[model samples]
Target: MTTTISYEQAKAYYEQWGVNVDLALKQLNQIPISIHCWQGDDISGFETIKSELSGGIDVTGNYPGKARNGDELRSDLEKALSLIPGKHRVNLHAIYAETNGQFVDRDEILPEHFAKWVDWAKQNGLGLDFNPTLFSHEKANDGLTLSHPDEHIRQFWIDHCIASRKIGEYFGKELGTPCLTNIWIPDGYKDIPSDRLTPRVRLKESLDTIFEYKTDEKYNIDAVESKLFGLGSESYVVGSHEFYLSYAQQNNKLCLLDTGHFHPTETISNKISTMLLFNEKVALHVSRPVRWDSDHVVILDDELKEIALEIVRNNAIERVLIGLDFFDASINRIAAWIIGTRNMIKALLYALLIPHNYLKELQEQGNFTERLALIEEFKTYPFGAIWDHYCEISNVPIREKWLQEVQIYEKDILSKR
Candidate 1:
């Protein structure tokens, strides 16, 4: 079978279904996805005296050309940002600091460490977000950080987090957009622990101290991320989803939901509405988890679609933030970034094209059969044509053409690395 639809034809078809193609494109253009910087370097950022990646974090393949340092990582990121549509933001971990052989520890980090990144983002018209690097440090070897049993260890992490917040605020002020500072500590016990409450209590106290100094909300926002479990922390994790969700609500902070930090059968779509309802705004770390929380490259899959649908249906685009959090070193790093990011945008656009009001009316009036039919019928719509048009207007390659660019990049650039 061979078929093709012209722009006029596709636009007319979408209009018939009460979907305004123009509106969809405009909405998608306004939404900026925060691409994780660690992907360029296989989660190995530019920190001196690096520690083993503890917690549930590990990158499998030793793909030939991984970014060894800051320069290579930035160069590859430039290639990636060029291909993706919309004005995007870059998410940076604390480990990616561009120190000029200063050799500062995490607890001693300051806004000066990321001065170049802030300048670069300003020149490129990009927003920036930050995370405190709580794993892969000598102190984190025991699979504990802020929630560590020792007070000195916990306070060290607390000071680091406090420094991270100041740095995030600096990025926000210098770039003229709010910088989201997220705290995700890999503190948990690999085996069954007799005392869980004490650790959590200590964690709460440590967080309280970190948040004691606040930056202007207009410039910076604070968030806490929770994980179900990780590599070493298999038996117990201190910061679970329930803990962070509750803490965020009570303390007036944003709750960051990582898609990979959930049970196999649990879909983040189910939690979106609740987060939107309770918090003033919510942040999301969208990634594909195959079987368990094995951070795989994202695709236009079922859970991703449902997640996009929930946001669009609730009209929570402005109230929610979308960020990518996955690293696959098994393939071309830049391609992995583009594929996952474009799919994130693609899923959102798909959700925007859905006629939600009409469908909701159908379900409310006892027309289950009609509603189900409409749902299935929507799957066959001219979504690809609309998507291609978006790519065209955004000046990016459409269909399979983008992959060819990646291949060329590999031959000329990534292959050399």
Candidate 2:
């Protein structure tokens, strides 16, 4: 009837596999997943000057309780964090800058615009991450930025990314944790491109100029994200995974792999070990893809478990930076955040409880049959019991109980919006 008693019983089962359940829970508590802020408002940031959601991405459903402003967004995020059993980071985009309703273009925006966010982060005891908004702007209306043929347009995005790095540095300095400022551009062609090399060259040059104005690594870390294709850019995307992978390796930067950005057949879980072998660190945007890069809410699917297993087995827990990236306006926004984030944490916990060493040894000894059988058997292990104990100990609601709190919040706080 009690969680402690159930957890003790579960511990014994894992102990038979030479697994340390207590250590697994301790490691799970120490790991922090970065929760994306865009989910709170359906990627509709509070920018004074707005543009249509373009650049090969779109958010559907008119969910009525979307946070309309910075304060409301943070309030909703606070509610979500209260339910998730960990101290996590918040991922922000440049378009979320607050300038008191003043029209501040992307390139001209400064660190001061995000001072409120930094202060709020400090108050909440959370780390912050950032992204440069390269789509949905006049400069990118032609679906080109950082790789545009026009010198003026290309330079504008370069300036914006440079400013974004400075803001990231400010956050890292103020918060005592390095801020990951990731760059994801939407420069591609809907159809076949007459010239692919030229655009990639321009993108490389623009990035060179942006990285030239560098900040201290202690305060800021830079990463580049690549995509297979997007809505408008069906046939060609300039920053393919190969392009950014090579760039990150040569430039000494982190490569951010978005789970949904790769082809349907491609799996980020398989890529993690290879990435860790080459790069000092790797970053992730954990999202689910329905058909294409749909950015669906993450679930405890097989791929999620594989991704977590890769990280834990390789002892790359500190080397991999995990962040959630999904936006669904069909349901309560806060509930979306809670579900996606909690699932991510659950995947990590599940991985932590596995006996990876024994599995590897079995493979090394050419015992494939045993490896497969043991892995499958472990799937039926009482993972839920350990997780419920974690939630109970973390002072968060257990299992579906959090849903009741979300419903109450929706009725009292979200419905009025």
Cα lDDT for residue 364, model 1? 99
Question: Tens-digit lDDT track for model 2 on 238-313?
Answer: 9999999999999999999999998899999999999999999999999999999999999999999999999999
Q: State, as a TM-score between 0 and 1, how close model 2 is to the true structure.
A: 0.99
Residue 180, model 1: Cα distance from true site in angstroms: 0.9
- Candidate 2 runs further than 4 Å off: none
> Considering only N, C-alpha and C atoms within 3 Å, which residue pairs clash in candidate 1?
55-231, 56-230, 56-231
Residue 385 lDDT in model 1?
84
lDDT top scorer = 2
TM-score of each: 0.97, 0.99
Q: Estimate, for each residue in 150-170, the C-alpha lDDT of model 1 and write its tens digit.
A: 889988999999999999999
Count the clashes in each prediction: 3, 0
